[model samples]
Target chain A: MSAERQGAASAAPDPRISMRGIVKRFGSVEALRGVDLDLHAGECLGLVGDNAAGKSTLTKILSGAYVPDGGEIRVNGRRVDFRNPADARVHRIEMVYQDLSLCDTIDVAGNLFLGREPMRGAFLDRRAMRDGARAMLDRLEIKIPRLDALVAQLSGGQRQAIAICRAAAFDPEVLIMDEPTSALAVAEVEAVLALINRVKASGVSVVLITHRLQDLFRVCDRIAVMYEGVKVAERRTAETDLQDLVSLIVGEKHVSKAAGAAAGPGGAA
Target chain B: MTAYTSRPAGSRLADMLATHAQLLSIAGFFLIMVVIFSVMSPVFLTTGNLLNVLRQAAPILIVAVAMTFVITTGGIDLSVGSTVALINALAAILIQFGIPWQAVVPALLLIGSAVGAAQGWFIAYQGIQPFIVTLAGLSALRGIALLMTEGFSVPIPGGIGFVQIGRGWFAGVPAPAWIAVVAAVAGFLALTGMRFGRYVTAIGANQEAARRAGIPTRRILLSVYVLTGLASAVAGIVIAARLGSGSSNAAVGLELDVIAAVVLGGTSLMGGRGSILGTILGALTIAVIGNGLILAHVSPFFTQIVAGAIILLAVWLNARVFSRLAAGTRRRT
Candidate 1:
């Protein structure tokens, strides 16, 4: 654990969102143990950890997909309890899940405005959805060839782009993304990374969870490393390099320079 | 960019054809059958015979329209036939017992909706397999109808206005056919143009995804079965009115005919894909086969044989050939 973590967070005095002592358990398996996280508005915080490190569980709790056994979340310093995803959504918190959570048979515009569709009287407003989806994609600088085509017909990067754009469309105060680029080709990954930065520029606090160590350097202002079910360390991206994050993620004692080099080079592997 | 993006890199015409290839395949089959029947029986294409065909096809079309909703959600209501029979027998017995025909219609429609709601509750809320739940209904509903009538056909008086729903004609078309048209148009609107249709497609395409997106998946799923139940009631009423009697034996195996029409029209059992237009065409095709075969001087038994064969062949080709083609298109795109 680094002593600098506390002050090394964003220079912003008031964090837009904060979670403290967020403990969750799946029966006897404790998935999250007293985790604390913070996000400043208009900045991306990267949550990095290995499998079963409870990164997903922690994010799911924040997104109201799961309830924490013990914890409190604050938005603008106001305490909030979210019983469901809808509750979290009311607070302008949104998440793009790891599975993508997209219907392959639906069109791009349909998937983008899924839960809250544009309706004119009794039917869907197709022209509105089409024009709106185009503007949404353009705002994020992602290009999807056809808005009417089924999502199954899109490239991996384009699908990921749609998911990100969908979450961003929530006009969220805090946006959480889980491995948004884990399934993309190289070019596509860059496109998504660029999307995240653009989204961050719009004053939305972003939580990004990814295993790709170098990606943290590109878009993240700060990196939080979790070991097992606990947050072992947090670092300002400028102060820490790949070696320190690699060591911290695997439990600082066993991280060798050789091991860090192998997992280095900023590729997903 | 607009020109390039408006049309994908693939040939737009080819894409359109490929996208609706299932619909076109069924349409082509329907047209060929019509031509063959017209050639064999000059009466097949005549106005009177066509009107008769529409009248006969009406009940099946009404129920199949609702079944489209059920199938689109990746479910089967095997009890639809029994539902029709139960309503048919129950309506007749009520009329015989001195209840006004007017009072019985809406009451039976409610009963039909209740039957569907029960099955849907079990499937959506209790986590029961839809097949098992509806299969139980298939057995139990028909049995209840048999008990109500004691295995005899109940006579419905020929003079009631209720009979108009089956035998009367308006604008030179049978009343039943008009009712069927309303059901089909409403169904087409719900499946193609409404938010209900979009959510139905999303739920079928990926239920968990739909749920996470804040769609009320369970409610949508349950409501689909209810639609089937309500449609089945209308069909039963139409059938009883036409025959002037009702029996527990009515519409026996009718579920197969409706399902065959739906599948033949290219609604995939896999649940995500549905086509109401394709369903109307498919039902009409089946009606023609039955009506045309008799006119062609073929044995009536062969009509059943052909309908059953067409069901098996359509499903086989879809599973083996069409799915492969769809996958190929998806891969290329």
Candidate 2:
């Protein structure tokens, strides 16, 4: 895999996107406190934190949903400013919001196309849209029964799948997802995890935020733990176990038993 | 997973029926109304009276077409009747000033767009609720009309081409009826076939989602009100032409009738779902009932009661019966 080749070639690979000293505040409450993050191409970075830990805020800044009060963002080493979500989209950044962002009354194909509908001389090219939507779903191996069904009629998993498909279909350079599997059934979660792997394999950088700690081990190459709006620690998947990550996430000064016993002196690092 | 397989081909008919249950039921109700009216009044079934009904229904039908778009966006344009009255009075005043009807018509339509755009600005940009904004417009606009006309009817001069819009016939149909037909057809095509219609539904379905998806939602919202404004102007012109006069009191309750027609046609006031065909049928049904009642020698006062009752009954059947049928079929499948 290209990702494997890159990992072996350098101790610190070049980042596709880099954020430095990102700061966000709501009135007197600071949501993010000068955070720095780097996402390499073709790698899934897991961002884990408890409630109000600023994980959502950081990702929203990257996705251009929120403007940081102080920050420098560089995409492929070139500095950029994102005034709005549309600006982020121009740089090929797409986000699957926590709410899935699917319109319930719109049909599957309609939701898939959403804001940018295919048109022929001012009229919606519905036939082409349906055909394109089918191809997109098929490419993602999403087993939706009907493309014409209203999104509200779909199961939670199916709706999630549609939302992911819409974001993925745009060929984004960086895809950010917030709590994607939070409300999914076990089987649906498996489907989404598999989908994440498929997206990563296609050479897109992915930033995933999830409370499901176990999920980070499955798809993430690296994990960043946040506490109280600060990036407390970062670890490569090969170097860190779940207990050590959990300790970092919950802000424990002492390492957990499994981690302490397994790594000895390395546990402190 | 196997349970999620494509629906059996044999059930396609059932599926179509279930999906379109609301539209089908409204159509059926409209036909039943026609039969009942035809039986109760001999004149109701005649070509002359039918044309007259269409002529009278023209204003409601035209405005209702635009209202469908507004409602589809989950918004209501309560100021439409006031817009119509203002345009009606304004058109008469212009005609009386010896301005050409040709110049007056287009100018009124532009004024309508300006009025709609102004309200849309408040609703979409200023974050005012559509109901409150349009309600304000409804009051303010009518008051402006009253002020302009000094609470009196402004008479239009006869023997002018302006009167032809209301009085003339085209290809064996009233001109106003023809205008309504064109409006209905355009509404149907725009809603079903055009990108604008898709955005309208999307905005109504979920404004945030639509905005995040890169749709210019606020502009689209603004445009729908503009559409209603333009439509109300056309309706006003037709009314002034038909009566040979314009009054501030004209079409006082027209908004309610237009909204009733749209809702009766199964276009949800909650938005994101609409059918232009249903609106047409709804408008015609209202017209037919009113005309038939008059012909049957029923008091005009009772007409409102019957119309309201029928609307309630039709909507009830739509929500209750059709939903149950759909649910039962889903369980069976």
Candidate 3:
């Protein structure tokens, strides 16, 4: 946020979030092997790869939904361990999952403040919640018919907005979006893209995991390519071509065995 | 191109009707029932008969209110009937045991909540299917109730106050009706106004999403079931007081009526939607149907058939209304 912090962020390679030698296994399948990643503050880092590239596994580990067998996660240059998603939230790490977790029976305000609701006296302060929800929606430039409307009645994009609003309201230092735009239409996707831009501008580090290269080019400042389980390459969005990135993901270009062993693209480490 | 756009408007109107068509259809059916009953018996329109219906509906209303919470979270409790029976039997037994009514009542309420929480723990944290877990509880609780009563009725303490709490009229209405109204209001507040209420709805809506959002989901689930159990216990106590006796067989087959009320009230059995007000209406509606049948001199066995039909009709109408509302909203999208 300060100039010195910004200078340190650009000068030193200390990422806002850093994962080194992360390994995760589900049963016999090693989903991720020795994967390493660096995410700088206020940067939109795109994670691009094929379906089995372990993007979700990496996301899960980073979000504290899953613990990796071997890895050190350093947040804001400080080494930390997260036991659960709640712990991750405390460390200013939040995720907007593709499913857009929400309660459809309640109104938008109730959904936005699902876990952490404002309270006055013994009551839930529904009025304050509604007003605060409206403010958050406005801040994110989200348009909905009414704050009191039940989420079940919302369009896909509007539901997505509620999820984004919740994460943003918490003001998490790292926001991971797992294909946030996948379920949306064109206009809705644009709306989400605008929100991403606003989040990035506000200096919250973003990790956008998507197979949509066009989305990566539109919003990501830097792109990280993951081939199989390992992060194979990191390229500035302006410097890297999509073809080169695709090549890196498919392991077409020559890569070090350490990286290859890390990737396990051949299904063996 | 114009027709494509223009036709949607007609379709939109049609969809709106389709979505809410069930509500209209149900309302029509309700009207038809009322007319038929009125024609069949002049006594159906009397205030005394209406009050009698409400008084009889009170216990089911209390249990159904709690059931709405459980069902909204996509769960069910077959144990409520057993729970009510146990409480009824206990209230009378405790009174006979020389336990003061003041302490006896609170103890029963706490015991009810504990039973509910016990069941909830198995469902919420253990990841057990609610139907299986509650069905086990349904049978288990009845066994416990029978054991407590030794398969016999326990006589009340023969106190005027205890009977007054159950059967006495405060202002031309039975005390049970008033207790039910109070409980329903309290249930409504706990669900819609408090943090716990919101969490329950959230869990019902999407448990996985709520978990990701850092909600204490399992705890909330446990608490909802406990609340339901406590409500059923209260219903049981009232039944004991009203009868001046507690029987192991008390509240037998009451689950069907409670569930009927819940479905009629428009709470989705599938999870993630419910209304306390609707459930109350449902309770009253079921009560009215039963009362009308009894007044019309229909066989008691036929009452069960009528209740089943009403429940089926309510659910059908609810689905119809739900689809129409969904279509209405979808058209806008």
Candidate 4:
């Protein structure tokens, strides 16, 4: 991103993506109510909350997996309506689902280019898929045994890498990753964190949803905390610590802490 | 760093074997069946008997090839036999009405595809179980055929060149076998190389994932059934032409044989894995068992019993012994 885009001191720049009054309901349960968010280019915004705090719902609406019951999403200053994930993809929005959304029977290269495979006349462009998969893995700094390996035989982290590689390879402008590191081992988490940073450096706006509070400080430029179905607080990562974030997430006396600097005990960043 | 650090990678050969353990086991078993049958019956090794076997296996091979696509998507079409009977009777009735053979063939194929499409819509779009939908098809379709033909065999006039489809030869190979070979090759190309085949496998593997990836999964699922229907029509035409008559009772247990052939070839009933080559071997294996048994003087009724036993044995070995063998070989290497 340009230098002006990174400065948040004054003269706020236009957000890469903006959402206003997002609301979603599953019958009697209100999943999200009147939630608004702004994401800038080349930044990772951490979304943290309890289970059903509307984090995943908000992200799902953003990724076009679910249409908000009422909301306006503006991307690059233009309002767009998405009816499905395919529509979101047209505007370069992508999400790595928590389930990983991968075909275990297909090879790595095939999974990377599932619906949009490169075809040569009547057949798949196998050579292109192989070389393209190699290039994407190289760019993301992810390694696996072979491009032709079936996903079922790969380790969990490798499978996660494949899922991440698929979303990142598509040059998405707004990438949402829901708990990418939830099931990974420790070393694998480090690798995924490194990969997230790599993706962010390429000037893509990223939304990361995770319960690992410690991970927020390491990768997020700003943290957004949710309580119930409402976004209760937003904090610049430099100005907040784990205690404050925890308090914000749990909605515990948020008003008193609101006035303080919230520079409590340092977190495990 | 590599994404996974748990273990060293195995040799490519070992990996390949493990990946294709089912195919390898079925292939080896097929070869073993051929050898045993040849030894058991002196006539089995001859060119004439093998061609006769090919002719007998042609209908099963053609339908089994299509069933491989259906099974690969984790769906079963139990109505294939009924489909054939319906198409067979309908063609005879249409021919008896003095229609051209050329027009009737294409017309029957379209009807077959329509029948399959109807079933597919319920299973794919309506979200019904394939087993239930096709089981209903099995009963309803044959009932229609029986009502149309009134439980009687309808005969076609001789020497209209239609019977050539079932009995005629080109380059000394049986015409039905040639048509089967064509179907197999086309199905093979579509399943292994084309985007259609990839999407079919993907749908079977993880349907939600495939859908989220933007694959037209329901359309693909629907199309596989259409393939089975079209293949059944071809089988029906071949049968009607060969016998000079159409019977509702024709191919009574054919669904069992086709399903047996597909499953025996190692296509999973649970979906996501398929092999056209395997289905060909599997159908041929079943045909040889039937032909070889009769030549060995076993009662005709025993063929069903023996074929059932073999299917059970082959699948058991593929899942248990051969899979372990594949893993063990990998570890040893």
iRMSD (1 decimal) for each model: 4.9, 4.4, 7.3, 3.7
lDDT of 3: 0.79
Best by DockQ: 4
lDDT, candidates in the order shown? 0.86, 0.87, 0.79, 0.87
Query: In model 4, which regions exceed 4 Å deviation?
Result: A1-13, A253-269, B1-6, B329-333
lDDT per residue as tens, model 2, B1-333: 411223333355676676677788888888898999889888888999999999999999999999999999999999999999999999999999989999999999999999999999999999999999999999999999999999999999888999999999999999999999999999999998888998899888888888878788899999999999999999999999999999999999999999989988989888888889989988988898788888888898998898888888988987788656754564311
Candidate 1 docking: what grade?
acceptable
TM-score of each: 0.92, 0.93, 0.87, 0.93
User: Candidates sorted by lDDT, descending order?
Assistant: 4, 2, 1, 3
Ranking according to TM-score, highest score first: 4, 2, 1, 3
Measured by lDDT, the strongest candidate is 4
Candidate with better lDDT, 2 vs 3: 2
Clashes of 2: 0
Which tens-of-lDDT digit does each residue in B263-296 have in candidate 3? 7766767777677877777777777788888889
Candidate 4, residues A158-260, lDDT tens digits: the string is 8888998899999999899999988888888998888788888888888999888888888889888888888888888998987778777757766465324
Off by over 4 Å in 2: A1-14, A253-269, B1-10, B326-333
Candidate with the larger TM-score of 2 and 3:
2
Residue A118 lDDT (model 1): 93
Candidate 3 second chain TM:
0.88
DockQ of each: 0.46, 0.39, 0.37, 0.47
